[model samples]
Target: MPLFRRRRSATPVPAPGPTPPPPSRRSTEELAAAEAHLSDFARSRPGVEAFIEPRTAVTDTTVVFVAASGEWTRRRVRSPQQAHALARALGVPAYDAGVVGYPQRMREWTRRRAEEDKRRLDGG
Candidate 1:
């Protein structure tokens, strides 16, 4: 090797094989769980609004339901597209949580719940 010239180390490169199909984000068990939760919410809560959260790098899409009383529930969904479809199928208006912030009613409900819990703990 000449001065100022670096020698390259030998390394074996593995041959590439056929790429596997992308893994599915939604599983059957998860879908079933979501359906059950949604069904219960619909039967119990009248006029529930849906909010669809889009997928991120680490998390899958999810659908949240907000009842008139501010009670809320969420479950994993197949994708953002499916979340919208689910809202339509459920006959509820759907908003994108990523685009618009979470509903005001939801925050209010959470606050009320927290306050109630605190009072109960204090025996008030």
Candidate 2:
């Protein structure tokens, strides 16, 4: 070892950068618009039922439309009121799945369709 020579350390030093800002919360109008858009999509699709799923996030609640065959479309809204409004505009019955649970008819239809598809795929 040479005298007055500096030893290099194996540890790496981290470089500092500016912290990112938190995500902005969606406004009520924005949420309502999203709900409307989703409802429109669902209504346009044949045999779809409009359903709402409540959420605790600041982004607002979610609105989903479950088709008779179990296919679904979803979007976020400001509140349940906005969801209902969108449902009415779409002319479909809107419901909270958490409270009412899934409709029996829709479930049965989906099951039958799945079984049929499986059988076809299996060539049985």
Top of the candidates by lDDT: 1
Tens-place lDDT digits, model 1, residues 6-106: 66759866689987645766779979889778868867898798888876667677889998888999888787787787777878788888788787889
Per-candidate TM-scores read 0.74, 0.53
Per-residue accuracy of model 2 over 70-106 as CA lDDT, tens digit each: 6666787666887788778777788887888876766
lDDT of each: 0.83, 0.73
What value of lDDT does candidate 2 attain over all alpha carbons?
0.73
> Which regions of candidate 2 fall more than 4 Å away from where they truly are?
1-24, 27-33, 57-59, 103-124
- What RMSD, rounded to one decimal, does every model reach? 4.2, 9.6
Q: Which candidate's TM-score is highest?
A: 1
Clash list (residue pairs), candidate 2: none
In model 1, the number of clashes is 0
Which residue pairs in candidate 1 collide? none
